[model samples]
Target: MAASHPLLAVRGLQAGYGRAQVLFDIGFEVHPGQVVTLLGRNGMGRSTTIKCLFGMLPVLGGHVEVRGRPVNGHASHRIAREGLSLVPEGRQIFTDLSVEENLVATARRPRTDDGRAPWTLERVYALWPRLKERRHNLGWQLSGGEQQMLAIGRALMTNPTLLVLDEATEGLAPVIRDEIWRTLATLKQEGLAQIVIDKNVKRLLPLADRHYVLEKGRVVWQGDSAALHAQPAIVQQYLGV
Candidate 1:
């Protein structure tokens, strides 16, 4: 892929379940080494958009491009092979699998041309050492925080060029949330592009390179951290903060 090209580009995306339309011409782009956030109040189509991106839900219309390749109607696994990985909502780890099993379940090597250090079990463990300690524990045996860490490590094990995280720090202890944020910061330093969704706008402001605020399934506002930080009312109005 060209260095100047976006890692992922979503343009005029339209998707929903069966007969219930949710997203309305949604659009966003994530570039190499950038952290872009999807901010919205609950049920405003944030998670729905993520599902569409990962090919978990078919798009009703429009397109999603990964590494500049159109993947609108591709299967989820096929999308994963195209250098995108997701830490989906609810940290859906395999209940019967051990922590090591979960990490290696969907692991993959990077493309030769990817030109980045491929993520290995060791690297992921280094990022989240608690996972190393619980390597033999089953997914269900871990606490929520530990499960979330495993979810992230599993995604990293895929060696994705772009990682998408839904609700990056929801339903966690404050300390755990801080740990997650710090890991994200470390990933940022390592130049891993990410698409993140979370309620912690305060934590995201410094971590994110750009912000897209959604409402009624539409992008109501978008700007960089400085702009978003300057406009507190935007958060109050759109995010109900």
Candidate 2:
């Protein structure tokens, strides 16, 4: 079901590294069960917006809310505890831990109110049987695709209220990327909220409920996929399509 209120909201969000500002007064939102895409070319502040959302960097200004509560300056761990899980740019699985260990390391009980079955180890393995076969393998032992699966499974194990992926399918084989996209579709069907950042506009447009295009640290365009589809010129101009 669509949320009456946004599950995640950012308003006039501003952030930077030292003296170099990356995000301006940018804003966007993700309601429950909605798949929203953060669209932009490299260095247009898409990642920076995500960093601010998860409290990886300090919020210079603006309101950052999760589940209708202000969380502007909270720590990353604090943000995670509030039910926001992020699959970062790199597949940052713990290199030393085994796949099974990694999945359980940050696991949290699923929320019962959502009317969805909580993700479990068995369920994750079912989603990707390769993971079940390699359960005892160290994180560093998995291929890039397997590692990406592990990263995602780890987040799912945490049972987040909102799952955010930065560069969701970057640098993976086409087959693996298809699997990832398929899994995302399944999650969306199950009513899990997500915000994905990927460069494939053709694929993303159909998967996402809404889209936000960023240009030079500002949100230049925002609309539903159909609206964006109607304006190919906009995609080509800002996204270099």
Candidate 3:
């Protein structure tokens, strides 16, 4: 199928910390109901790109657009309210809060025109049944996989149109990682657009619609899954796995 208008677009994005520039002319797009993976080894501006998108870092240059609306200079909260949600690298959850509370804390009613009701505690529980079993457990009490699920659930509570997951399956057991991947596949079936950062190319290849390979603060390659499969050398060279 032909790609549609991007739900999120990054054009000529440049960002840095203090005097050091990290990203150079970074650009990519994530269409509705599509999953886009940003692939790179450590310190190649992957996280920096995400920070710029969420306004967590100052943008030295470039523009970030959501649904074609400019959000380059907007506050992080404002950016999120505009239907973009980020699940940061670490499974950042409220340790003192109960499972249900954490999910409800970020819950937002869906817009009237959204055509679907906002996600409920029950729906989230269904996605991760362990959360339902530990509905009253604190964030710290949950295992890594459970915490990851809670983080994703919290983001879903916001009823975002686009979900950005930084290191989605970074540090989990093999089985847990499989569960996470299965959940992502389910979300894909439900038509959620996502920007995912992960190193598991084998799993990512099947889940993501497109891939962007970054090297030293720039996108070196961009293409669909089939194209990526045809270029294993490119993956071996840049990914180093």
Count the clashes in each prediction.
0, 0, 0
Using all chains and alpha carbons, the TM-scores for the candidates as numbered come to 0.96, 0.97, 0.96
Q: Highest TM-score among the candidates is held by which one?
A: 2
Task: Report the lDDT of model 1 for residue 27.
Answer: 92
Over 1-241, each residue of candidate 1 has an lDDT whose tens digit, in order, gives 1267788999999988889999999999999889999999999999999999888898999899987889988999999998889998999999899999999999999854556778999998888899999999999999999999999999999998888999968899999999999999988888889999999899999999999998989999999999999999999999874
Write candidate 3's Cα lDDT for 1-241 as tens digits.
Answer: 2355678889999999899999999999988788999999999999999989998998888889887889988999899888889899998899999999999987887643556556889889888899999999999999988999999999998888888999968878889889889988988888888899999889888999999999999999999999999999989999985
Predicted structure 3: lDDT: 0.89
Give the range of the ten consecutive residues with the poorest summed lDDT in model 2. 110-119
Q: For model 2, how does the per-residue alpha-carbon lDDT over 19-132 read when each residue is reduced to its tens digit?
A: 998889999889988999999999999998988888888999889998789998888988998889999999899999999999999998975567888889998999999999
- By lDDT rank, best first, the candidates go 2, 1, 3
Residue-level error in angstroms, candidate 1, position 2: 11
| Selected candidate, larger TM-score, 1 vs 2 | 2
What C-alpha lDDT, on a 0 to 100 scale, does residue 84 get in candidate 1?
89
